[model samples]
Target chain A: MSPADDPCIGDVSEGHILRAILARTPAAEHALLGPGDDAAVIAAPSGSVVVTTDTLVHGPDFRLAWSSAYDLGWKAAAVNLADVAAMGARPTALLVALAVPRDLRVSFVEGMADGLRDACAALAPGCAVVGGDLTVSSVLTIAVTAMGDLEGRRPVTRAGAEVGDVVAVAGELGQAAQGLAVLFGRFRDGDDPVPVDPAQLAAGERLALNAQLRPVPPIGLGPLAAIAGATAMMDVSDGLAIDAGRLAAASAVTIALESRALGADPARALAGGEDHALLATFPSDGPLPPGFRAIGVVQPPREDAPVTCDGIAADPAGWDPYRDWDATAG
Target chain B: MSPADDPCIGDVSEGHILRAILARTPAAEHALLGPGDDAAVIAAPSGSVVVTTDTLVHGPDFRLAWSSAYDLGWKAAAVNLADVAAMGARPTALLVALAVPRDLRVSFVEGMADGLRDACAALAPGCAVVGGDLTVSSVLTIAVTAMGDLEGRRPVTRAGAEVGDVVAVAGELGQAAQGLAVLFGRFRDGDDPVPVDPAQLAAGERLALNAQLRPVPPIGLGPLAAIAGATAMMDVSDGLAIDAGRLAAASAVTIALESRALGADPARALAGGEDHALLATFPSDGPLPPGFRAIGVVQPPREDAPVTCDGIAADPAGWDPYRDWDATAG
Candidate 1:
């Protein structure tokens, strides 16, 4: 049965809510131990674990009125899993802490669980929601901690990009930002005119909107890139320009982007955010890895200009969680 | 300088906030890869890892007016660490997801970092806050995921206790509930007449307040209990009656407690919450582990009575995050 047909989260006890979640999201293969225990045991094949955390708050992160519970859950999983993937690790387990208002629906929790499971099954096989905490709060928050296994591979960090490296990307970019733009334009001034169905839209429009609501980062490509000898890597949660600037700063080098290679609007690719694409740098002579295409080149650091596009400096107008961009835009 | 002397979280950029946190909490030994990267890599010496998560929301879980940021941080670490210890693992790493309002003081964030560091240094040496995500939210929330190493020991699960096992607790109880009582009585409504200082309260009173704020669970004792042949174990975040009931139910047995052995008021021990003690059962033939005193005995499953004290059935009155017991009490 659909979560909407179930009891409201507030109407049922926390125990019921947990049972619902567990019933839906069966334990994946890698989980030596799953939920119902004080803690979970997960295999660490390389005798190491890669960990990253992300949080999605209701207001600043997503508009509750626009995104479904399933979307929230998918985005939460996508963003966190992408972080683990960026480190050249195989996504393994997730520990979630979900807090919602008492008035929320039980179906929302179930949809969320389904989203987490669906995302894991699709993006990173064997990744499981091993354990989590649920609490009550005025603001809904989905906090996720993702752990990964390196399997004896070296971690690809942003600091290893050397001058003379080829800069590349492994997934779509500028789509989520374009989707958010459409969402804000469509639902402006609290006037919601029956949100447009993603299916009803054109291919590009559907991709954009879905990107905004449920991002699917190239998770599997991370370890592949590392094995293929990529030196520096990061998930582009921020705009490409901003994230690339971070890589440049970390590596003490300059990234020179070729605008045409991105396929999407060059400016949007540079400035729009949340597509969660994988950006990496490889040795100049090494072939670009599968699922990745060269988009730029790494050059000696320039004190004032860390990242540039076609020889011009690129602005770092990435998403900042603290900014009230919605208020101004709305 | 103290956190109180710092800037506000809202005024600075995310970069500045990250810098401050990284500066304050340096990586520990196990972090093969630490902060400044997309994710952290930690050594899992046991080839497997124990993982757990917990969330502390602003209004429901704590009152900022009463509990300092330092207290919140320490408690977050303790509660999650305790879960790992309950599984007979040595706490190794922590990944924090912090969400707070824009108006929060930067000093608060700093104090929280310090608190996390202090708790690790004091309670579980070598454990570190290797990575975290900080975001802006309407309500303050601290979500922590703790990872532990079992060192090749068998995980003491809650399902192994036999009918003839002896039940024991590894830490204090009822103190946190008592502290909450004092806080509620002292600062009810918006009156806020400067909460009682923990130092000024009597030793017993101080213990209660401190327990409510910065719970230092006996993590070290958990491993000892497991090594000494604990059959079943769990961290007592809920009151003894409730958590023990859960243990009993999971093990398909009943726990009969001796009121005199608990050294606290029977009702308080059974109903109070947030004490975060270790509740374990061992074979009756084996001696109680060091630092544990027998408080109960396991018995065959009783259809009506799941947990009893002094031969009288004890109701499970554990803290329910979904329930607003505070508003009713106030």
Candidate 2:
């Protein structure tokens, strides 16, 4: 393809770029009013709307060479959807605010819009992009806010976990971190990132890469856990070790994990971030929800640490944006 | 103040920075569940929610030398709130997504939080910041999503205006643009922007600067106009000429404005951007809403242009981020 085939977004009008993106956006099921308006009206059936916002910025969040526009869009939507689901609500709509470099091609934005539509279709059936804002910037940033309906159920909050509750999880825990390791270890040339070559990846490595790029977190299990009388819930965005510790602190209980239940790589499972798996607690006597697997038990608060593995304190190390983001590496 | 006294955000944990901001954020009247949860649960008394998102980027949308952290936060909230107001809804909550450079001071972020709180208090009394996200980015960006309740009234969209409807506006027009002119015209060193000097400004220039920095749009008038039976409504972020043309196009009618009604500086009002005043249409027979004043009338569609001034075609020229942002100016 010739360079002229892909005109930069800077070369077009806002309406032209908007039309291209809107062409790819599917109709939202819960929207009473959609785009081309001052605001979108979304049906909040239970008289309450669940909302959360998450952002993916270049350098700290992703490297352009590694993440395609689709990957970036998918991850941005998935992450925010995970937050809404963690509150035991069904996602109804997404409002994306994109600030991108002017030099980027319009097709890149269309690819992102496609990814947003596909993610919503796959993860939450009725949810779709309802409205958005676009701005030009040197940094490529995707900030997505996902809204949801609780359908009359009480919201599941992290502070509700009771002592003696069963700690459970639904979705892969360490895969995303493994994918990050794969990229950092093999795909980088010196301090700069290089595009991934599928031929160089093993079967499991490819799976890991997909998990990192287009994570399919078990979003449905969130409402299922709530319906099954789960005591508390949260998305494990910053690994089990750190996130469980946070949950424990919020609930004023200690989370005791069994090392053997952590699967093949316990260390990575304990410290990995961005998996966005639902970490929840159900009453100890009740059977665990169908999609959820018990990994730990909630105990009375211990003075030593908020979380433990096989009765030993586990370090709650997780990705801290300010501390961990390496600007030079991106 | 010494730089040592104002620590960089990178020097602290995310929790530390969050606590500082959270301390300033007041509770929302409609928030069923606030911050600390995975997502905020906002009350939607009418069984539906009005949602909109708007972003302010460092280079294209604002310049740090000209806009203080407080000004940036206030303007970000004001713009998104106006969109909700334009929908004839009462804003209930705001979710902010902020991406800042690691080198920014924590105090700067705290000041932004203060501005967000004050804007909500002054503009929309019951509205407040309910949830937010923080991320690291090379370019500073503030993306805000505002949610509102329709209060059982039908949404007043831009497509509803009919021929003979009176075109009216609530809030100031072109003031923000005049403020921008003041900043660009007076507060620049070569190509780079410099801090605004109040001492050098005349009284009216100060008001213009305030309008640009902290816009106090007539937010309450939106629902009032809706109650008074507005046929169509939209915020005038772009100049009246461009935005009215959009409204006219949406409604398939021609908006004929009286230039005499457009204040002293009609040309500036027609071409300036970012004022965010509410532009609406009402039945010609009805008395104008208390806070709104008539500016024009709707007529049959015109082949030449959607908007006209004194029966002459008006150019729909306004700021285009991609075309107008100068990289070296900021």
Candidate 3:
């Protein structure tokens, strides 16, 4: 569509924009009552629902020049889904709350809805957008709340790991962080962010870029791990070293990593974040689940550090919005 | 606390801020798993859970000069709870997503948590904040998702109203809008919003200001309406004329309102919004619910407007953020 065909969202009515978005949203499998009501009713066959909320803001969370509306929507939904999955639950529905700039086009909103639908279809089937709220703001923000069902199984928490448990990970670790490196190192024009040039990216870098833009965490493996007698589980969103340290602290144990198991770039794997890989602990007596690969072992709590690499204390370096985000640098 | 004690959130770690806020948050009655986890698990005893989301942005939604941190938090939770209540369900849990500026005070966040706790305690007694996400943003925003339980009763939707139903409301009308008017008319200094002066207000204005700042919608009366055999229900976030018209269009009926039934200021009652009053339609044969009073009667679909007052067409005027919000106007 041409610019004439794309009207500014501010020029239209809220209902008009909502209708366009609602038309793109798919029917949720677990919805007893869907949109166009005061609220939507989602089925909870397991007698309880696992829910989590995550937000993507314009500046600190993402840059518009680097991330498209589709990528933003997908990342927002994927991150929240990973949280629910980390709790050993099957995602059922998503409720999106969008605060968009009025100057943006209506098409951007439509693209976001499509992205939300496609992400759910690809990452966690049977889950879809059941309800949402839209309002005007100077900053473009997407906040998503995801709900899931446990399917008669108990939720796996980070505090469940025992000393003898084997620590394992599923999905990529350093790829998303590598993508961030690519964006910062090659795709910037002075202090401002510029769009990525696909031609400049190598095959590996392209994969890394995709990992950063739209992470497909091991969603199905969460329930699998729970069923396989896994003791602890959490998604690796803020690097393996930092997240592993969190798990260790929560469980009151120390985790010692095997450097060779973390792929060729062990340092990158330990420090890279936003890949949304599943980090879980299983009993040492049983075989690890099909998709998960053992990378560490839970040990008695040590005074030095919560996590260690090759018998040495590892740096707990990861993204912390409060300490790391600098609006001027972006 | 002294000025040195109340440091900016930018100086503190995310964990420090979270711990401060969590210390003030009350334990959710329906929570199987609460905060400090990847996700929260809320009990859905009736086999299904009702969910809805609403957002409050800094500029269009509120101004820091006028509303306190506590007011913002209370309003955010109260608004979302009203939506779930309108679905004829008892609220169970709330998941908050806060995108705040780094320069704000940690004490402000703790106050917000207290507001969320107090709002839930006052409006929906059993409900409390179960989980939340906090991120940095240029524009402060609060996005809340509320979940509720039906307790075996089917939802009372706006589409279920019949021609013979009696239109009723269970809360004050025009009060919030009156409060807004007070702020705009008296508390502003040119383009910027000035702090509200309580010493300059009368008793009625104080009440109106409180209504706008922290609305106490009749949350309990929602389930009561369902048990009282109400055919249709909705919360009047927009003005009665506009929201009633929406309900009429959804139910394929016309609403004939009695102006005499409305209190003294009928025009303000018809046009003002944000009161979040529970509007319902009950069978003409049954007595009205305890908190509700008759306002109008449902009629067959007409060629004219969806809503009428004193047998004449009533104008549908309400807040539409896209068209109504002007950044320069404050």
The Cα error of candidate 2 at residue A79, in Å, is 0.7
lDDT of 3 by residue, B1-330 (tens): 986999888788778988898899888889999998999999998889999999999888888888999999999999999999898999999999998888888999888998999999999998999989898877889999999999999988889999999999999999998899898889978767899988999999999999999998999999999999989999999899999998999999999999999899999899888889999999999899899999999999886879999999999977443245464244
List the lowest-lDDT window of 10 residues for candidate 1 chain A: A321-330
lDDT of candidate 1 over B27-145, digit per residue (tens) = 77889989888899989988999999999887678877788889998999999999999999999999989998787888789889999999999989999999999988868889999
Per-residue lDDT for B223-243 in model 2, tens only?
Answer: 999999999999999889999
lDDT against the true structure, each candidate: 0.86, 0.91, 0.90
Candidate 3 residue A1 Cα shift, in angstroms, is 1.6
Candidate 2, which segments miss by more than 4 Å at Cα? A319-325, A328-330, B319-323
Superposed model 1: Cα runs more than 4 Å off: A1-5, A190-194, A197-202, A319-322, A325-330, B1-5, B190-194, B197-201, B319-322, B325-330
| Order of candidate numbers by lDDT, starting with the best | 2, 3, 1
- lDDT comparing candidate 1 with the true structure: 0.86
Tens digit of per-residue lDDT, candidate 1, span A1-330: 665577665577778888888898868677877899999999998899999999998767886767888999899999999999999999999988999877788888889998999999999999989989998877789999999999899899999998899999999888898888777666555643245656656788777989989999999999999899989999998899999999999999999999889785898888778989999999988688889999999999988789999898988877443256442111
Ranking by DockQ: 2, 3, 1
Choose the strongest candidate by DockQ: 2
